[model samples]
Target chain A: MNNEKKKITMMFILIATLLFGLVPFILLTKRSGELQTGNMLGILVVIIIALLAAVIGVKRIKDLKQGQPVEDELSKKVLNVAGARSFYMSLYWLLAIMLLQPVIADILFDSEMLDAEQALGGGITGMAIIWFLNWLYYQKKGVN
Target chain B: MKNKIKELRARYNLTQEDLAKKTGVRRETIVFLEKGKYNPSLKLAHDVAKVLKTSIEELFLFD
Candidate 1:
């Protein structure tokens, strides 16, 4: 497919993924119990993903309207750099979370919160945000 | 590395958009290239040089 068509398809898939994420989020929130810190973090993650999708969609649409190719060599380079940076940063982030898990649990839950799922969720959310921000930065500042 | 892309493009009466289109890249890529902030791949450098009717060494000046 052409670049424009490819970008549009990618945007649709992102939106669809965001919608799919919301289904589980809604189901979890509707459970017959008070929302936990983990649940709140999950909701925040969804919101961040939705916002990222919107930002990317608007930028792609503007580029398309201006008859510019959305995917090009520079963009590919920026993406690669961003992905690498985020991956590296997320490793540190996960380590910090793991090391501070007991302190976090004491402060937030007043008990042991040794839930691997929540830690993994937080790591993934942090990685996504870091990747998005890095992409935006390199896109504007130019990647070498 | 600095390049003479802007000067060469002007000699050919080509705007950045036109050069980008001819080189099959985004205008932002051309903008970055002209500013010497981005280093293009061998393929992209060759393509841009070919479009401007110049050799790669002539198009991109290495400091």
Candidate 2:
């Protein structure tokens, strides 16, 4: 694989891993009276990691942009196709979540209806996961 | 999309940075166009092509 692809994939791996790693901490923060200085430190660390990941991700993306002389028709097609696929997939997720909100609220966890904050936290995290997964997957595999 | 931006920029000997500066876009957008990983908006396509002294059709090719 080319250096550009490698860098991008590495960035994705970093981001996905960070997301997965932070989930538990973020979950802990959702519980009332569970907050602590350590939790604050953890959040701070996660933010720092995310910032670093963004820098690397942006660099990798920028690196791809540096290849203008040979940029060609196939590249555009690949971009558009992948973009469209990611778009549709994420849109479907958005719609599905909207449609299933009540059922998901009822079936998944008992507190979903009572604790609006936790429910929203979980929902946001879930959606973000889906979004990032789609982008990473499409970027890696190309569009179907 | 196939672009003659490179060739035209070369004709004028404008670097990607120069073209990007002139076009009010990021150097990355210029790079993306060059790499064909980005398809610019019609307005952008026209603007770049015009600045480079080419037609949009000549600058972009349909798959």
Candidate 3:
């Protein structure tokens, strides 16, 4: 498919994912108070996917409007650098979370944390946020 | 790296969009190239040089 067509399809998929994946996950989380490990992980995963889709969808729209290709060499390079940086950052983030799990659980959950699953979910969410932020930064600042 | 993309583009009566279209890249890539903020791949450099009617070595000066 052409870039425009691919982008349009992606936009549709983004909308569908948000409507089905994110909304249902939110509803499920609300229905289940003091979320189970699986529930928390599910919600975080959906949120990360939604966030990434939203970013890419917005970028594609802008590119289409400007008559630019949805994916270009510069964008690819920036994405690679951002992904590498975020992956490295996530390792430290997870390690820090693991070390401070007790305090974090006390502060955030106000109860005993069940296991590493919740921390893992939180770590994954953090990683996604970091990746998104890094991507935006590199896009604006330009990669060497 | 510094490049004469902006100068050469203007000499060729090409806007950033025009150059981008000819080279098959986004206008932002052209802007970045002109600003010397991006290092293009060999293929992109060659493409841009061709569009600007110059050699890659003459277009890009590496310090």
When summed lDDT is taken over every stretch of 10 residues in candidate 2 chain A, the lowest stretch is: A67-76
State the fnat of candidate 2 relative to the true structure.
0.00
Q: Candidate 2, DockQ to 2 decimals?
A: 0.05
Distance from true position, residue B54, model 2, in Å?
Answer: 2.2
Candidate 2 lDDT score at position A35? 69
lDDT tens per residue, model 2, A10-93 = 878877888787777677766666765445544555555576557647755764666432233433444566556656666766
lDDT tens digits, residue span A1-144, model 3: 775777678777766866586676667667867556556675767667676877687778877878778878999999999999999998999889878888888877676663666776787788888998999899999997
Model 3 pairs in collision: none
Predictions' DockQ, in order: 0.83, 0.05, 0.83
Can you write out model 1's per-residue Cα lDDT over B1-63, one digit (the tens) per residue?
Answer: 999999999999999999999988999999999999999999999999999999999989888
| lDDT score for candidate 1 against the true structure | 0.86
In the range A30-61, model 1's lDDT, one tens digit per residue, is: 78565777767777777777778878888888
Second chain TM-score for model 1: 0.97
TM-score, one value per model: 0.86, 0.43, 0.86
Q: Which of the two candidates, 1 or 2, achieves a greater TM-score against the reference? A: 1
Selected candidate, larger TM-score, 2 vs 3: 3
Q: Candidate 1, TM-score vs. the true structure?
A: 0.86
Q: By lDDT, who's the top model here? A: 1
10 residues in a row with least lDDT, candidate 3 chain A:
A33-42
